[model samples]
Target: MTDRIATFPDWQTKPTVSPVQGDLVYPGWLAGSWSMSSTLVEMVAPLAPEVTTPGFEGNRQFLNQPVVCQVRFLPANVVERNKAILPLLSLPTQSLVNAQIVSDRAFNGLNLAKAYLGDRVFRVWIDPRDSNRLITKFRDNRKLFSTATGRTVEQPDVDHFITTELFQQFFQSPEKPYKNQVETTTAYTHQPDNTVTADQFTAVYLQPPHPKAFLAGDRPVALYHYQLKFVQQGVR
Candidate 1:
């Protein structure tokens, strides 16, 4: 009989840290209302060359026109936990939460919609240990399960940041417009003139056999590039 041996993975020996203990800070410059415009610059369908993927038609429609949006950030109570205080440890220890609201445009810019595609409120948490790093949590009504991580760079005349997010859609059936994963990278610069500009790139990967000859892992399905401009209106 052959001798059998068992081996454990290296990750099993590493320690895990809790996410709740991390501190979150809000940037003062981003706390205000603004008018934002997003334009689709380029798009490519790598996997679905024969058929049109979902959302491609809409992107083409907005390729020549810009989509307008109203964005606002409101102050909210931030709470931190104190382990020293046993009975009231869960009480308010910090106040750094902000409520973000984004309104969508409709009717060919003739009218604004009462409802928004991003109607749900979003929250951003800055890392206490590192001011440049932050995390964003999406609302309940959002279409995908997403985790966003960002880093900021401070300059003399401009503050620049890059955010990368991983998204997984909530589709019931596997055949329902199969999308395995989507990654979005956005680079924003806060200019000296109090305006912000962003260049965004989004890539969608799909399960294989949609393009059978591709590699074993997920294949690239679509690529989208967008340009965004935000003009400060006033404080909310």
Candidate 2:
């Protein structure tokens, strides 16, 4: 898991460490009430077709704004014998999952552990420079139960963004059978209710140059594109 305190070296203020922080990220360029509709294009790995529901398709559906990007609520190794880890001690073993929203363009994120899993928790950090960027990091220390004797492997960076005007992706394998690309652009408009509809969000995906039996002749896969929308409610 990524350390929340270390992630924001330039934060305007110290975050009040808690189970949730959705309200803090709203009303800014990064915050808003958002939703999307995704459509699948190709099937490379032969996985089951994602079930489409109302207003969206695929498991890569909507990205509700201000969702928790990361969390840690329980100790995976230590038993809550006598409730040593807080309120959880009164009941059973305490384990927590921290979920947070790393970006509004896509479902980019990072998760950390406080007292569970291995001695080191896992984390996914997005590169701030690229809209479709991500980085994998790990945390090992006395908190998670690591005695400094083990080395945790870093996670591989991934781009969940798919080429579509709606800024969504296909629920495909993480090890993309073929390299994929994506880009996103954003804008905003004022609604009559005083809330601003932050629209003009667009994304595009193209298969990176690669040798494939399917592309034998002069045929090529077309690039994919999508557009997304969100509403930013002004703080009263």
Candidate 3:
């Protein structure tokens, strides 16, 4: 029975895993705040303009103005989305930290002085190699299914000259849990003319169950690419 007792003790004394920590600092190019505006120019032929959908007008023009952008360091306790590191964090037993939110118009530059952009906040993290290659993450909790789920944010590489972004638009729907899911990535480069040029993704809309969802679709959606400019009004 002594051997059995010894085995029990070893099982009880197993070591617990700890969370991974990081102290990624924000870069200088992102030190100041930024304002973002986008115009959605959809496809003409494949979009089925005659579908009679208000939001799905073929070659439709949609505008989003003055979206705020910021760059900053993430807290040490926050874990990078490393699958290998997750098990080490003891996440199954402990709850993850809540994502921070920033909604002030001054911070977001949102004209929400009149209204607001749901819940506006973003957190940034640094890749261990070079701090210059920083990740910009965005989140809006109001888009979550419930307060429990919180908002989903993604990390994308961004630098002073160019950046890559990947994200989805979230919404609550009656037929399904979420609606109008979009996954997109655009390449942005700073121009010599003091404006930024977006090599926006040419493939826009993909059919349901998305790539992240691990489901297949009828065909890969195509994007209509364009060169939109970003100009800082007050910069001297």
TM-score of 2: 0.28
Q: Which stretches of candidate 3 lie over 4 Å from their true place?
A: 1-31, 35-37, 41-54, 63-170, 174-176, 202-218, 222-226, 233-236
Query: What is candidate 3's lDDT per residue for 119-176, written digit by digit as tens?
Result: 4534333335632233333363222211111122222434333222222334433445
Best by TM-score: 1
> Where does model 2 exceed 4 Å of error?
1-123, 127-132, 136-177, 200-204, 207-209, 212-236
Q: What ranking emerges by lDDT with the best candidate at the front?
A: 1, 3, 2
For residue 196, what is the lDDT in candidate 3? 55
lDDT of 1 by residue, 1-236 (tens): 00000111111111111232222233445545567787878777654555445677565766747778665332332122221112222322232123421111111121212112343435434345543233333465223323222222223233865544444433333335343556555666778887888877676655443454244244345677788888876433
**Model 3 TM-score (2 dp):** 0.37
Better of 1 and 3 by lDDT: 1
lDDT of 2 by residue, 143-183 (tens): 11111111111122221111111122332223433333222
- The CA lDDT at 55 in model 1 is 71
* Residue pairs clashing, model 3: 202-223, 203-223, 204-222, 204-223
Question: Which lDDT value does model 1 have at 148?
Answer: 28
Candidate 3 versus truth, CA RMSD in Å, comes to 18.5
Question: How far off is residue 16 in model 3, in Å?
Answer: 35
TM-score-better candidate, 1 vs 2: 1
